[model samples]
Target: MYEQFTKPILDYSIALVMFLLLSPVILLVSILLAISHRGNPFFLQERPGKDGKIFQIIKFKTMRDLTDVNGKQLSDYERLTLMGKIVRKTSLDEIPQLLNVLKGEMSLVGPRPLLPEYWTLYSEEQRRRHDVKPGITGWAQINGRNALSWEEKFRYDLEYVDKISPRMDAKIVLVTLEKVVKRHGVNANNYMTMEAFKGNVA
Candidate 1:
């Protein structure tokens, strides 16, 4: 009942309210990012969504397009600017994804959408994460986020898929808020971001 009708309605309503409430923060971040990125404030990338459909996910531009002498882009740790680091640390970079929720490409809770190229790398089981709309935060995110291994994260994702319910969603939402407030699990211990997931090796 909730997943079908009530969840979408709640998602849309909450997304609209949150977007309006956070408009000022969004604007300020956009302006700062525009200045830092030289006019581009939003980062858009094709991510696989429900049923493996591709959609352009939107986020705040938190990295500079700096390149090496050979023209290869710099590493995430290098390209991340001062303000970008702040925004990322505070999770303000995820604000734009509310728009994705409003647009029906995402949900308030679900498996986080990953890079499209990774579609081919997922095991048949891992690929099940895309069975529903991706979210700004998810069961994996609340559990350990970047700190969890790829296998562990996918286990949470699949668990969420199987046990989705209003009670479970509510718990995830509450825990996610606590995690965010504590600024926990935002990045891996030795990486600027979570390490990319490679296919599981035997």
Candidate 2:
């Protein structure tokens, strides 16, 4: 009942409230990122949504487009600005996703949309993670995020899809809030962000 009906309505309402309540903070960060990056404050990338639908996911741009002398791209750690690190650590970078939820491309609680390139790489079981709209926070995110291996993360995503009870979502939400407050696992141990998923686990 919650998944098919109540949850979407509730999620929309909550997103609306969040958008209004946090508008000032969002605007401030947007301006900060724009000034720091000298470009668009928000970055949009196509991600596979429910049933493999493509949707543009929005996020605050925290990294600069710094290239080396040969024009080779710099690493994330190198490109990440001090403000970027602060935004990422506080998860203030994700505020724009409220707009995505408002646009119906997402839910408040579900498997997070992954890179579109990951579509071709997913095994049948792994693909089940996209059975519902993506979310800003989810079972996998709260559990470990960058700390977990790709296989473990995908398993959590599929697990969330299979058993999407309202209680479960509430738990995920609560845990996500706590993680944000604690600023845990915001980045991988040796990477500026979680390492990109190369392929399905063999």
Predicted model with the maximum TM-score: 1
lDDT of 2 by residue, 1-202 (tens): 7788999998999999999999999989988888888889888899999899999999999988889999999999899999898999999988899999999999988988889998998898899898899999999998899899999999999899889998998899999999999998887789987888888656
Backbone clash count, each prediction separately = 0, 0
C-alpha lDDT of all candidate models, in order: 0.91, 0.91
Q: Cα RMSD to native, each candidate?
A: 1.0, 1.1
Model 2, global lDDT: 0.91
TM-score of 2: 0.96
Tell me the spans in candidate 2 whose CA falls farther than 4 Å from its real position: none
Clashing pairs in 1: none
Q: Give the clash count for model 2.
A: 0
- Stretches of model 1 off by over 4 angstroms after superposition: none
